[model samples]
Target: MKEYFNNIYLALSTIFIGMSVTFKHLFVPAVTIQYPSVKPQLPTRERNRLYVNMDDCIGCLQCARACPVNCIEIETVKKIPDEDLGLTSNGKK
Candidate 1:
């Protein structure tokens, strides 16, 4: 008999607790945002791309080492100080 009453008390107390939580949430303001109608603001600084100028690259593996994806491959010929190569597209010798 005592165990039966304990079980009934436990069930009622759980139901009361659950209903209190539900009532608390029912009175709270809704935090949901209407999507598609309102767009979120993006960050000002974008790091979505990596731009490199081949003219300025000296075949150093620093970029490859710094790259997170390890996708950068540099291939260049070492030119002699006296050797004269044609001007680049930017007109730099």
Candidate 2:
């Protein structure tokens, strides 16, 4: 008889706790945003794509070689010493 009452008490306590949590959240303000109607503001420097600075590149081909997917293709041409190829922004020939 004692075990039967304990089981009933445990079941009622569990239900009360669950209902209390549900009712608490029901009164709270909704955090969901209406997608097409309300657009999210992004930062000025947000980078959604990759950017490479060719001027600073040393043509080492290390990036291509290190790619696990082997998707990067790089080709290099040797510049003639007599021709003026010009200097980089950092003054490197």
Candidate 3:
């Protein structure tokens, strides 16, 4: 029937389209980098910073919660109710 031919045509067209993409990529050179040996240079304008000073941290988990990779871990100890830990350098109690 016409429907059977249409299904066959659709399957062949999709297969050709998918194989075309695979063939195009097969001829292209690989862009994989040897990360341990060759480090990629960053832009001059980029700070490329990845450090956080614990002393300056306000115990806010915003950085940890917002991290895309979930790499930042914050462990806070419960302070005694009557203990006075004093204010931070930024005057945060």
Which candidate leads the pack in TM-score?
3
TM-score against native, each model: 0.37, 0.38, 0.38
lDDT of 3 by residue, 1-93 (tens): 999999999999999999999999998987988987998888888754356767677678877876768898998788799998887667787
Clashes of 1: 0
Residue 5 CA error for candidate 3 (Å)? Answer: 1.1
Please say which candidate is ahead in lDDT: 1 or 3.
3
Error of 3 at 33 (Å): 1.7
lDDT of each: 0.80, 0.80, 0.83
| Model 1 lDDT per residue over 6-93, tens place | 9999999999999999998998886876767876667988466566777666678778877889898877789999997666658786
**Ten residues in sequence with the least summed lDDT for candidate 2:** 47-56
Listed per model in order, the count of residue pairs whose N, CA or C atoms clash below 3 Å is: 0, 0, 0
lDDT of 1 at 50: 68
Q: What's the best-to-worst order under lDDT?
A: 3, 1, 2
CA lDDT for candidate 3: 0.83
